[model samples]
Structure formats: C-alpha cells, structure tokens
Target: MDDIYIILVASLFSISCGLLGSFLILRRMAMVGDAISHAVLPGIVIAFLISGSRDSFEMIIGAALLGLITSFLIEFFHKKANLQTDAAIGVTFTWLFALGIILISVFAGQVDLDQECVLYGEIAYVPLDLWITDAGLNMGPKALYVSAFILAAVIIFLSFGYRYLHITTFDSAFAASIGISIGLWHYLLMGMVSMTTVAAFDSVGAILVVALFVVPAATSYLLTRKLKSMLLMTVLLSFLNSFLGYYLASTINGSISGAIASTSGVFFLLAFLFSPIDGIWIKAIKRNFDKSKNTSKTKFNKIFKE
Candidate 1:
C-alpha cells in the first residue's frame, strides 16, 4: 500500500541517520548534519549542470564531496584559525548555502529546480516515484531502495570501524596516542552523513533529514549510557517516530515530514523530562527524596540525644 511504502521509506531513512548521528552526538558535532544538509545545495546544482540530469547518483556524488569539504572547512577553521566550533560551523554553512542560492539564481532557466522543495521535502510523494523495471514490473518506490541501501551501508561502516570510531569519538587524544587517525575517521563519518543526507533529500527534505540525524540519537543518548544500547534504542525510536508521524499527519491532514519531525521532538521532550538515567524530573525527585531522608535522620538523632 502507499501508506506502508511511505512509512517504510521514512523508517529506513531515520535508522540510517540515527545510527550515524550517535557518533555525531558523542563528538559534539551534531549540527554538522545540519550544515551538510544545507551546504550541499551547490553540489546538487553543480551535479545537475554537469550531468545535465537530476539523477540521484550524480547528485549524491556531488553532494557527498561538498559535505566532506564542509567538514574539513569547519575543522580547519576551528583548529587552524582559532574560531569557536559553533562560529566555524555558522560561517561555513552560511557561506556555502549562499553560494548554492546564487548558483540556482544564475542558472534559473536551465536548473529546473525548486529550492523550497529541496529544503522541505514531501514524503507523501514517495509512493508515486515508483521504480518500474524496463519490462514493466513495479519494484516499488525508488526512495525505498535508496533508503535501504544507505541503511545497509551505514550498518556495514559501523560494524567494521566500530573500534576506531568508538575510540576516536570518546578520546581523540588517546586514539591519537595509539596512532589512530582521528581526521581520517572524522571525514569518513562525515562522508557517510553526506551520502545519507543526499539520499534522503528527495524523500524527506534537508530539514527532516537533520531531524532524523539528531533527534532519535539524542533521545536514545538520554535513555542509555552505553553506545551500543543507545544505537539500538535509536533504531527503535526511529521506527516509532515514522509510524506515529504517519498517523498523526493523516489525522490532521498535515505534511508527513513535518509530522514526523514533530513526533521526534515530542519523543525527545519526553526523554528529556522522564529518562531514568538523568532526566530533569527524575533528578528533581531524587534531590527532594534525598533532602527528606537527611532531614529525617537529623530529627532521629536529636530525639535520641534528648
């Protein structure tokens, strides 16, 4: 069904983004996904110009290259130019994003692209973009296949490079001391993020891609301390966001991508307030209980002395 296809594509995209996002959250580079998402606009335009087609593969290659460059520029600014990380990210993304807009405006007649559509995608259209075979067989939505491939690639990357990524993420100093190339792994991670962003761009748009990248991972991070547990929880939460968001959109007659993003935010708010590990409400309750216990102990001591 169309509903099932749309939800499936959303879930796959969420899982892929959430998995890589765990590492980004750990490294304090969560916004890097946001940067890459916007900064890749020029790459998409260039790819279109060069390939003379809006093919996904060319768009991905172009965007992935730009994403890597964005990562490098951010790091270069932070480490070499002594800019704060946030400032560096702000400068880099804005500059590149502006360039993309310029390119689109300059080639307005030839590009045949809409920046608004690219930034805020329409996920409900997934079922219509069917991947039909040459022989007239319906293989299903092309977005589904793209999302699945990205998820599979992310899983493979994490599985083999877990040790390096884990070490580099938590302790770059120790990893460097042990001869691990932090820069190499960082770029590789960014490359994957870029690919995921580009692949999901058509289906969910840049805005929702950033949500999928950060929200589920952040929610899981609050719920669990272990990286492995956080990743597993993120996958589960991604599915929940997709399913709930679909139904919510249908009920309200709203945009599916917006509903999914809103659902992710809701879940994140719940985790922020109620997570057992370090939730705001839970910590407040613990503090109050501790105070009461101390007060009771002091009262008992005074009575005993009397």
Candidate 2:
C-alpha cells in the first residue's frame, strides 16, 4: 500500500512537470526549469526560518515568490547587464543554491533538511508523511494531494490559455502584435513552474525535478512536431516513468527518484534513436541510401551513353 501511494504521488508530480515542461521546451527555455528548481532552495530555507514550521502553504508561497524573483533576475541580467541568457540563469541559480546550503548548514540542528536529500531526494520516505484528518480518517500522503492540485492547475491554465501560450512560445513578437502581453504570460508561466517545482522538490529534490520537467517533454518534442501530440506523449511518458521506475527501484532496492529519472532518460534515448523525421541514425541511414541511389543512376546514365 505504501509503495502504491508513493507511485501515485510520483505520477502526479511527473504529469504536472510534463505538462508545463512542454511549454518551456517549446519556448527554448527548458533550462529555466532547471534554474528555478535550484534557485528556490533559498526560498525554502527562508520560509522554514521564518515560520519555524514546515507548513505546505508557507513553503509554497515562499518558493513561488522566489521563482518569480529568479525569473526577473535572469531577465534583468540578460537585458540590463548584457549577459547571455544562459549565463544569467547560471549566475542567479548558483548564488541562491549556495546561500541555501549555507543556511542549511548553519541551522543544521533546527532544520531537518540535508544537502544529500536536496540533491537526490528520499522519495522512499514520502509514504511515511501521511495526511490525516481530524476525524482520524486516512487521507493518503500530503505530497499526493499537493501534486494533484498542481497538476489540475497546470491543466486548467494551459487549456484556457492555450492560444496565448502557443503564440507567445513560437512568436513573441506576433503575440505582442496581436495585443498579447508577453511579459504577463511569461511571468505567469514562470509562476506555474515555480509552484510545480516546489511541490515536486520534496519528493524528487532539485536535481531530479529538472529531469522530470525536461526529459519527457524533450523526448516528446523529438518524436513529434505538433504541440498537441507532444503534450499527450509527454503525459504518457511521465506515467510510464513513474510506474516502471517504482518497480525497478523496488527490485533493486535503489533510489526511487533516481530510477525514475533514469527511466525518463532511457525514453529520451529511444526517441532520439528512432524518431522518423529528426533521429540521428535515421538521418544517417537516409543519407547513405540517397548516395547509393545517386551512384546507381550515374552508372546507368554512363552505360546508356556508351
């Protein structure tokens, strides 16, 4: 039963990350997910310090706020300081992440978080944190509920704002020409990323959360060009990772989060190898076939001329 709950929780996190990650990948901002996930560490630490309690609401609010700040800082560095986008992201996230480590070490006795857990996560312990009602009703894991809510929010926002998201993603100038506020939509998207990252950070940690966000979406993108197909494929792949990773971890007595991340990477490798349109090996084979055909046509032409 505990294993089942853990898988369910992981599934929710995977689905939520996949849905939002599709947009991030399309916008060529896939690394922003990585940036935000790591940058939120300081926010989590600060929230813990202020509240002195690990309440979900406080943690989420703090992380989400910092996610927005991280986005703003990245933009500021890129535009104001003339730094490259990647450099800006690297600078901002590294600073916050370092700060978070310092805070954790300083408050080692008070805080329960560990550097190791932030890096890889202890998802096996997720099942232990059950959410019980005052009536003594078993309400499953709190992580499950939080992840499910974030998943629903992502679906609803994407469903309604599909046009805006699609336009802004492929053509920000066009979106602006049509009177869309690109900045507004961008920050809104970042907010979603922040909340999703914070929610999954507990179960998967900062490093692995980036995998869940980017890998499935990236694999799906390689497999298909259409947005709808990519989104559907991403969700399906997330579920596959969650279930298969859980079983694999159980069989090997390894880290569940690590196994799940590995599963996502495996799917990505398969897609990269076999995708019909853009796969590296497929392109190589096609080029070889074309060369052979051309060579045969040249030989036939010479023979006919002779």
Candidate 3:
C-alpha cells in the first residue's frame, strides 16, 4: 500500500538519522547535520550540470562529496584557525549555501532543481517512484531500497565503531591520551552523517532530514542516560513519529514531511515535560513533595518539643 510504503521509508530514514544523531548530540556537533544538508546544494547543482540528468545516484555522489568537504572545512576552521566550533559551522555552511544559490541563479535554465522540493521534499510521492526491472517487474519504491541500505550501513558502522565513538565522544582527553585517533573517528562519523543526509533527501528533504537527525535522539536523551538505551529509544521514537505523522497528515490533508517533523517536535515536548529521569514537570513535583515532607518533619519536631 502507498501508506505503508511512505511510513516505511520515513521510519528507515528517521532511524538512520537518529542513530548518527545520538553521537552528534553527545559530541555537541548536532548542528553539523544542518550545515551539511544546506552545503550539499551546490554539489547537487554541479552534478546536474555535468551529468545533464537528475539521476538520484549522481546527485547523491556529488552531494556526499560536498558534505565531506563541508565537514573538513568546519573542522579546519575550528582547529587551525582557532575559531569557535559554532563560528566554523556558520561560516562554512552559509558560504557554500550562498554559492549554491548563485550557481542556481546563473544556470537557471539548465538546472531543474526546485528549492522547495530540496528543502521540504514530497514523501507522499514515494509510492509513485517505483524501481522497475528491465524485464518489467516492480521492485517497489526506490526510496525504500535507498533508505533500507542507509539504515543497514548506519547499524554496521555503529556496531563496529561503538567503542571508539563512545570513548571519543565522552572523554576526548582520555581517548587522545590513550592514542585513539579522535580526529579520524570524528571524520568517519561525519562521513556517515553526510551519506545519510544525502540519501534521505528524496524521501524527507533537507529540513525534515535535519529534524529527524536531531529530534528523536534528543527526545531519547531526556528519557535515558545509557547510550545503548538512548539509541533503542531513539529508534522507537523514530517509528512512532513516522506512523503518527502519516496519519496526522492524512487527517489534515497536509504535507507528510511537515507533519512528521511536527510530530517529532510534539514527542520532544512530551519527553521534556514528562521524562522520569530529568523531566521538568517531574522535577518540579519531586521538589514540592520534598518541601512538604520537610515541613511536616519540622512540625512534628516542634510538637514533640512542646
């Protein structure tokens, strides 16, 4: 069914982004995903110009390369130029994004890329974009295959590099002292993020990709402290976001991507207010209960003294 296909693709993309996003959040480089998403625009344009086609594979290859360069520039500025990390990210993404706009303007006739499609995406159209065999067999939506492949790749990357990523993320100084190449792992992580971002473009677009990258992970962070638990929760939340978002969009006749993104935010708000670990409402209730208990104890002491 088209509904199933759309939700499946969204869930896969959300899980991939959330898996990588967990680490990015811990590393305080969550915005790097945002940077790469925007910075890859020029790559898409360039790929279109050279290939003279809007093939997904060519666009991904080009965008992935630009994403890597964006990562490098951010790191280079932060480390070598001694700029703050935020500053580095700001400088690199804006410059590249502006350049992409310039290129689009200059070659308006050649490039068929629409800014709205790039930013907002059209997940509702996934079922229509089927991959057909040469013999005329329908292999389902191409977005489904791409999302599944990316999700598998992300799982493999995290499984193998968990130790290095965990150590480097939480204790960079200790990791460096132990001779673990933090920079190498950092770039590798960034590379994976780049690939995932590019792959999700057709399914969710850049804006929703960034939301999926950061929201589920962040929401899980509030629910748990253990890295493994957080990851599991993130995956669960990703699925919930996708399913709920789809139904919500159908009910309202709205954009699926926008609805999914809004659903992620709603979930995040719930976690922020209700998470047992450190939720604001829970903390407030605990504080008031403690105050009441202390007051009762003081009263009892006064009565006993009297």
Candidate 4:
C-alpha cells in the first residue's frame, strides 16, 4: 500500500512534467527547464522566511514567481544584451541557486528546510504528508492533489491552444505573419514549465527535475516527428518509468526519484539505438549494407570487363 501511494504520486509528477516538457523540447528550450528548476530555490527560501511556515500556499506561489523571473532574465540577456541563450540560462540559474544556498546556510537552524532535500529530494516522505479533511476523511498525499491539478491544467491549456503552439513552435515568422501572438505563446509555455517545475521540486528536487522534463519527451521526440505522436509517447513513457522505476528502487534500496530518473534515461537510450531514422545502430547497419552493395557493383564491373 505504501509503494502504491508512492507510485501514484510519482505518476502525477511524471505526467505533468512530461506533458509540458514536450513543448520545451520542441522549441529547443529544454535548458530553460533546467534554469527554472534551479532558479525557483531562492524564491522558495524567501517565501519560507516571510511566511514563517513551511506548509502554505505562499511558498508555492513565491517559487513560481521566481521561476518566471528566471525566464524573463534569460530572455533579457539573450535578446537585449546579445548573450547566447545557453549563457543566459547558465548565468541566471547558477546565481539564483547560489543565493538559495547562502540563505539556507545562514538560516540553517531557523528553517525546517535542508539543502540535501532541496537538491536530492525526499520523495519517500511524500506519502507521510497526508491531507486529511476536517471531517476525518483520508484524502491521500497532499503532493498528489497539487500534482494532479497541475496535470489537468496543463492538458487543458495544450488542448485549447494547440494550434497557436504548433504554429509558433515550428515557424515563428509564419505565426507572426498570421497575427498570432508568438510572445504570448512563448511565455504561456514558460509559465506552464515554471508551475510544473515548482510542483515537482518537492518530489524530485531541482537536479532530478530535469530528467522528468527532458528524458521522456526527448525519447519520444526521437521516435516520431509528429507532434501528436510525440505527446502520446511522452505520456506513455512517463507511466512506464514511474511503475518500473518504483520496483527497481525497491529492489536496489535506493532513492525512488533517483531510480525513476535513471529509468527514464534507460528508455531514452533504447530509443536512441532503435529509433527508425536517427538511431545510431540503425545508421551503422545501413552504412555497412551500402558498403557491401558498392563492393558487389565494383566486382561485377571487373568481371564483365574481363
């Protein structure tokens, strides 16, 4: 029963992150997900300081706001200051993460937070934090509720705004020519990424959050070129990772989040080797076959001339 609840909570986290991650991967802004995951740390610390309570809505809101700020700063450096996108992302996330660490070090005894939990995560504790109603009804883990809501919200946004996102991602100039708000869609996607990043931080931590956001989506991206297929594959792969990873963690006596992240990587590796178009092994086999064909042609010409 304990493992069941953990897997269920993990499913919500994986699905929500995987859904938004597909778009991030599509726009080639996957690194931005990394930026937001790390940048939200300072906001979370500040929120805890001001609210004086670790468990409250304010902390999540604060973390989300910082995520948006991180996105904005990256854009500012990239567009206005002429810095490359990767450079901007690297600068923003490292600065914010360092500030968070300093705050944690100074206020170590004051707050209930620890850098270990912030970096590596303590998802095993998630099931211990249950949400019981006033009437004494068992409502399951609080993390499950938050993650499920975010997942539903992401699905709704993608469903209603698919056309706009599709156009903007593939061809921004065409979207602009048709008077579509490219910037609006861009920020909307970032907003979704920010919310999902903050939500997953508790369960997977900032470091492993990148795996949830990129690995499944990237594996799917390699499997198919169509957006719909990629989205479906991402969701399917997320579920697979969550279930299989849970058992793997139990067998190895390891961190559940870490095991899940590793499992996602394994899936990506399989796709990399077996995917029809861009797979490494597939290309190697094709090259060998082509070389054999060329050799046969050369031999046939020599024999005919003789």
Candidate 5:
C-alpha cells in the first residue's frame, strides 16, 4: 500500500486506542490493557489454527473473546481468591502469553508469523498488499478502514453514554446504585480495548500495542481532569505522535512502530515534566504561587485590621 495511506491508517488506529484508553487510566485499570495486549497472542494463534489463516474478522472475534476471558480471569482471582490485583493480572497474562510463545516456537515452521512480526509489525507495508476492486483504483487498506470505523464507534458510544460512563469510571458502585449496569459497561470497555489491540497488531504489532493504549492517554490525563477534554486531547496527542514517528522512521530507516512508541514516550515525558495541572514541575510551581498569594493576603488582612 501507499506510505501516506498507511501512515494515516496507523494514526487513526492510535487515536482509537487512545480514546478508550483515557477511561482505562481514569478507572485505574491501565495495567489491564497491558495484560490484555500480551494475552491476545494465544487467541490469535488459536484463531489461525481454526481458520487456517490470518483472517481479520475471525481473528478479531476470537482474540476479543479471549481478551474478555483474560479480564474475567483476572477479576475472578482478585475478587474470589483475594489475590492482589497486580498479582492476578501478572500471573494470568504471563501464563497465557507464555503458552502462546511456546506454541509459536513449536509450530514456527508451519505458522504464518514470527516473533519480530508480532512485536513490531510492518506499518509501512499495510498499504502495499491491500484488496483491490474492479475499478483498479487504490482502495484503502482494510486495517485502516476497520480502525476508522471502530474509532468512530467508540467516539459515538462515549458521546451518547457519557453520563453513564463518567459515573461508572469515577464511582462504579454509585453508578450501579443509580441504575447503570456497571457489569455491562466494564465488559464493553474491555472488549473495545481488546478489539483495538487486535486491530493495532497489524499496524504496530503486539508488544508495542500498549504504547497506543497507554502513553497518549496518560499524557492527556496529565493535561486534563475533565473526561471529554481528556479524550479529545488523547486523540490529538496520539495522532501527532503517529505522524512524527512515521516521518522520523522514514528519515532514520528505522521501524515505524518503534518510532511511534518512542514518540509516545516523548509525549509522556513532556506531559510529566511540563503539564500545567498534574506535572511535577507544574505542581511545585502552583504550590509556590499559592503560598506567595496566601502570604500577600495575610499581610493585607493585618493592614486592614490595624
């Protein structure tokens, strides 16, 4: 496919991932995104075995179902077995991913994938081998189109269900008491995360998928406290990083996914150091300013009293 189109699609995919990820971070379930991304390998492998190829629809369906299962397992262990949340996530994801790794190693000769491909996908090549139509005109790549629709779906869902999602993310118990099905919302959010991960795999690959999931949203969180604003900021940051990363990779003759991930890291670094609301530097500055203002107010009050 064309390089330009590939870049566009890749950026759109990142944007979609960032949208859902904003909520994940707000809900303090950021680690679950990481776990789901890793645990998806087994599902993809199983889907391939059943379908006998890397079919997009089938793979996504199978992968998303398995991702939900992984989340369910983590929840089960945490609630029922009383394990630490982190421990539950670690044990479950690692076990599943390890099984997938072993399966790949054993079936290396027969399988259509490789470790390198899984970790860092060829985003630059997605537009090259796209399905064409009778007109001979270049239709967009499937990954790009699929990601766009999914992103739109997520944005629409968040828009209409803003009230419910906001309440649930901030306080699930309260949301439930108020008539929201916290259970449905939780599953829906995680399901979207899984779907994004699977769609992103073909663009940035599996290991780096979390970059799309976490970094841009995190950077946005550092910049905004409001949910809708944060989601918008996340998408903007994600797309900017994607554009910069893709261009930089062209310059250095490097991997696109690595470039995008590194770009995201840079975004997080900037947000951490300079964001006006939650950044370390900004927080300190605000504190000092507040103290100076208070001192001034105290002197003025004493003068008035005198």
Candidate 6:
C-alpha cells in the first residue's frame, strides 16, 4: 500500500476513536473503553472457536457484543453488588483478559493466537492488504478504506441525533427527563466505541487505541469550551498526529502505534500548558500579570496622593 494510504487510514481510524471517546470522557467513562478493549479478547477467542476463522467481520461483531456484556456486567456489579464502578471495571477487565491469556496458553500450538499480536495489533502490514480491487489505482490498505467508512458511519449517526447526543453527553439525568432515553444513548455510544476500537485493533493495537480514543479528545475539550469547536479540533489534531507520527516512526524504525500515542501525549501536554482557559502556565502567568497591574495601580495612586 502507498504511504499516503496508510496515513489516511490511520487518520480515519484515530479520528473515529477520538470522536466517540469524547462522549466517554465527558461521561467519566473513559476507562470503560479501555476495559472493553481488553475484555473483548476472550470474545475473540470464542469467536475463533465458533467461527473457525479470525474473519474481520466476525471478530468485529463478537467484540462489540462482548463490549456490551462488559458494560452490563459493570452496571450489574455497581448496582447490585454495590461495588465501586472503577473497581468493578478493573476486576471485570483483568479477569477476562487473564482468561483470554490462559486460553491462548492452553491452546498455544493448536490455534492461530499470539498474545503479543492480540495485545499490540497489526498496523504495520495494513498497507499490504488489498480491500479494493479493479481500479486505476491499487487503492491500497483496505483497512484505511474500511476505517474511513466506519468514521463516516459515526459522523452520520451523530449528525442525525445531534441534539439528543449533546444533552446526553452533558447531563444524562436531564436528557432522560426530556425523553431522550439515556439508556439507549448509552448503549449506542458504547456500540460505536466497540466498533471503532475493534476496527483500530487491526492497525494501531489495543493499547494505542486507548490512547487515540482519549488523548486527542481530552486535549480538544481542554482547548475549547464549545462542543463543535472541540470536535473539529480533535479531528484535525488526530489526523495530523497520525500522519506525522507514522512518518517519524518509519524514518526512525520505531513502533508506529507507540509513536502516534507519544505524539498525542505531546499534544495533551501542549494543551495542558498552553490552553488559555485552564492551562497551568496560562493561569500562572495571568495571576502574576494581574498582580503586577494591581501593584502598579496602587503605586500610581500613592504617588498622586503624595
């Protein structure tokens, strides 16, 4: 696959993950995405057993369903067992992840499962795969094409349900009072998240999907108060980070997903230090400048009185 195609696919996948993750972060459910990402492993294993192949479509469906199950289990423990939400998520994910590991270990030589491959995903070979055939161009890296479609699907859904999604993102209680069906929205959001993360698993790996999901969106939220502005900025930042990070990784012989995550980390750090509204340096500088102005005003008044 062409290098440009790789960049395009990475951008599409990263942006899709980031957009869905914005809501997760707003609802304080960012870690839920992480939990679902890891817990889906057992689902993948089961899917392999039942389907007899690691088909992308089957894996996606299986992972999404398992993600919903993870959500239900978390809710169950939180509501019925009176467990803390974070603790519930942590427990559920690790146990499932461990079960997946055990399954792989037990059937090591018998099946097509690798623990590192499962955890890290396979982004490097995305360009070599052919998803589209019979065009003037090879239309390389079918993963990019598929991911772009996924991103478009998310955008369309969000567009059509903008008002309801907005209300739910800001305040679920208020959304429910207004007949928005917060429960439905919650499932819908999780479903999209599940799809995006699973799609990303082919290229960016599981760990970086978590990074891509949260960091760009969090940075955008910190940089802008308006949701629209945040969304636009997040998309742009995600694209740029994917392209530049991939180029850097290729040039330096480093992990592409890790490079992208580190690049996003740098972006978050920039937002933390430079965002005008809530940035640490911005606040500190404004405080010192305000103090200086007040001191100058007081000195001027004293001089006039003298």
Residue-pair clashes per candidate: 0, 0, 0, 0, 2, 0
TM-score of each: 0.95, 0.95, 0.92, 0.93, 0.91, 0.90
Which lDDT value does model 2 have at 210?
A: 92
Mind giving the per-residue lDDT tens digits that candidate 5 earns over 13-130?
8888888888888889889999999899888887877777764678889889989999999999999999999999999999998988888888777678787878788888777656
- Model 2: which residue pairs collide? none
Could you tell me the TM-score of candidate 4?
0.93
Q: Per-candidate RMSD vs. true structure?
A: 1.8, 1.8, 2.3, 2.2, 2.5, 2.9
Of the two candidates 2 and 5, the one with more favorable lDDT, higher being better, is 2
Put down candidate 3 lDDT per residue, 53-133, tens digits, no spaces. Answer: 754668778987899899999878998999999999999999998898889889999988677878888889899988999
Looking at model 1, residue 30 earns an lDDT score of 84
Please give, for residues 89-198, the per-residue lDDT of candidate 2 as tens digits.
Answer: 99999999999999999988888789888998888888788889999998888777888899999999999999999999999899899999999999999999998888
Model 5: how far residue 304 lies from native, Å: 12
- Please report, in order, the local distance difference test score of every candidate based on alpha carbons: 0.91, 0.91, 0.91, 0.89, 0.86, 0.84
Give the residue spans of candidate 2 off by over 4 A.
297-306
lDDT of 1 by residue, 102-172 (tens): 99999998896778767778889899888899999999988888889989999999999999999999989
Q: Candidate 3 — worst ten consecutive residues by lDDT sum?
A: 52-61
- Give the TM-score comparing model 6 with the true structure, all chains together: 0.90
- Decoy 5 TM-score against native: 0.91
